[model samples]
Target: MSWTCHLDETDVQEYVGRVLGTGYTVADVTKMHGGAQKVVYKIHCRNGFACVLYVWDLTKNYFQEEIANERVHERSFGGHSFETNNRWLRNHGISTPALYDLHTGQDRYPFDYALVECIEGQKAEAYFKDPDQRVRDEVLERIGSMIERMHANHRQGYGKPDQSGNPRERCHLVQLENAKEQLSYIVLHNGSIRKNHDRLLAVLHELESRIDSRKRYGFIHGELGPDHVLVTDRLEPYLIDIEGAQFFDIEHEHTFLELRFGKHYRYFQQNGLDPNRMLFYRLHHYISLTSGGLKLLHRGFPDQVFASNLADYHARNTLRFMEEWQLDN
Candidate 1:
């Protein structure tokens, strides 16, 4: 039920005029699309200016999942916050976008624009699909190093939470709760597919129990995939499209990375990552995928190969992760 929007130059000029007074004008408006929840617009102002606009969907009848303004606001908080956190990440050497102006009060302007520095890079998906093995390895190494830096920055509190109710913790609670609620809709919403409902229910219980054991884990991207990663022409890696950023159970993020690059770990090690942590994350990544908790995301996955392999991998790792990590053991 979502649609793409392309804003004209006139639209941008007016928006900038409204926000920054009569003298200023919009140089250009570019659409940089990636996030599923919201549309992003990159902007350039008349006087050597640049920024981005994060638009949320509020035109729907039913506000479900990440659709509602409530949830959308929760995910992004605001263009201002995203700008601040992103700049903070960059300051800590995370290679994120540079903040300019956030669209916090952009209602006067139809298409919101947050001024930002544009990143020059290729998407991470191209790294794996690139035919040259050496190039792929180099790209993967840069990717791993970038993610490590991000985690290091996060641990240093670039995106950590404080009790305005601990944004990280609150975000995690929301994602888990949202996932549980979605599971209930299997019978109500999906198109006539039913099997082992009870088993699925049990899996949910197990996931909850595991997450509860470490309710105070830390911040997570909430949503992680190849698309979230950007590789610059200079071979720098950056994280973008944080529209679904949140604090979630650590293992979920681990699963996300493993699912995408698990088989390439042999190369990952040559890049100087700890094998045990990588293995742990990879195994739990399997747990994160096949676990009933992932049914909500699998709809967009193509073919049975991905889901079936995920399921088989999850079964194999269920005992391993639980026993080794003693998660709800």
Candidate 2:
């Protein structure tokens, strides 16, 4: 079951020039960072303005037949998210790349993609080696506040008193259930994969109960790893790669923020960075990492670097969950 992309291979360059506009002379087609679902590219058009093009592959890993069917009905999750940023910028005073042109081929493959304005800047990750702690602290705080803004949108109108008790939204819960069911396919047949997966699921089930007790609900970015956030030269934040985005537990995003920032938590402690959100954040991290681990296990595990990280992180997470919470007897 390979996905046959709707992209007219023969006409991509021609289409870019004609449909989107001239100057998109296909400077070069470099593979975008991250996974293979949507081919990302920084296409330097013949025109002065550079635009990033995202080509959706109907057969990519996440779009594979196994799990997409569960959460794949909305073909334009990425596009919708782009629009969210567009609106957020227009309404909330943030600066997002202006959307240029959109291309959809429902008549052909029921797929949609867009050519968007590219913000000229360096990625935030590049600043890891900066010598100034105060500068890094400001950047970190800026990032945190931006995330808090998003969580605010999800819980629009809720005040300070409403922050702590929001329950998980249904759509995110559906994704969780979908992940479990899809992974169960491999786990039941493969012993090692199943063992690690079950450990993760057990933790998630407990997290689910804790989430259920809340009366509040808010939209969550779901996937907020450092890769998705960008830092421009002026210290501005731009969040990219949101196709996998969904409304879920707001805490679900905290794990990556913690993991990425926590690596140097002791140093960040002087800057007022709190590691308090690591709990629920780790829960979702376990869920996402296990899902990836099970898939990779079948695909021949990646480099030992990543494999070892996943193995260690997954095991630590499972053990930590049991030690942290008491389950109902």
Candidate 3:
């Protein structure tokens, strides 16, 4: 049976009424974009109050069943991870959407859900497209500083915020294993990966050998990009989609910033980053994206073009990185 849960106007209205208290009827409920594992809706009340609702239902999840089941601790999902990471960021002075209410049990609904403050601002990604260069620079600078502040919060061990106990495997080793698994899947599904499988694996192992051990891990929004940031009128940035927040190698986050920000990444660059780790993580990231995009396509994600493009783009990037590594050696 397909697990997709399609919420109608009445369903959203009832949910809004319950969360917002009596007498405030829902004026509108508009579905928002960018949720792959959850459903998001922007709720407008008759009283002019607005908020965002996140519903974590299995029907909306597009991950391969095995991956979804196995990587439960790695990927941020459900109300528990959201609330835990939200509180952690707020406690550390990082800006994130305010959580108004959360329900992890199915007594109220069939799945976990939460109501959060609706940030009124453009996404940082949208702002980066402004014709004004100063506007772009200001946005980049604010994001850079905010990220720096987050990374400054250090931890002795690394893992998701909600994960307990000392990890048995080194962070880099675990990441390498993840990359291998992703690449293995990509090779089976993607023709491009099949052709370049050996070269890509060689590049991954080559970079892996160069990595050195580290004791400190920095707090990071695991999937941070401009789109994940909401900028207010005053130009202050608030992080959204923050369930993946964790203490990990900050280099992993920088690699993603470089990919998402493109030429604008210079503004978000950090000093003292281990070059080897960055290179390794960069390759691993492309592999992960390639695998994830393919999985989404296989699982019938809503945006077929997006899934195909993401998979193709990252697959090409993986090959390109492999060629670059060969030239450098």
Candidate with better lDDT, 1 vs 3: 3
Against the hidden reference, what TM-scores do the models get? 0.64, 0.71, 0.92
On the 0 to 100 scale, the lDDT of residue 256 in model 2 is 58
Question: Model 2, which residues run further than 4 Å from truth?
Answer: 1-10, 18-26, 34-36, 72-91, 106-110, 155-207, 212-215, 263-281, 300-308, 323-329
**Could you tell me the lDDT of residue 25 within candidate 1?**
62
Tens-digit lDDT track for model 1 on 134-164? 7887877877776554444233212333213
- Candidate 2: minimum summed lDDT over ten consecutive residues — where? 156-165
**Whole-model lDDT for model 1 versus the true structure?**
0.52
- Where does candidate 3 clash, by residue pair? 3-59
Residue 67 of model 1 has an lDDT of 39
* Candidate 1's TM-score: 0.64
Candidate 2 lDDT, 1-329, residue by residue in tens: 12222355445577677866664565554445545346666665556556776666555445365434533322324455455545544465444566676666556555567776677766666666779977777676777677666655544221122124223334335545754664566465445556666555766665555543333433444556556667877888776665544334455455556666656332322232223334545655654565565555555543546754664566466456655654532
Give the higher-lDDT candidate: 1 or 2.
2
Give the Cα-based TM-score of candidate 3 against the true structure: 0.92
Which pairs of residues have clashing backbones in candidate 1? 50-116, 51-115, 51-116, 52-114, 255-285
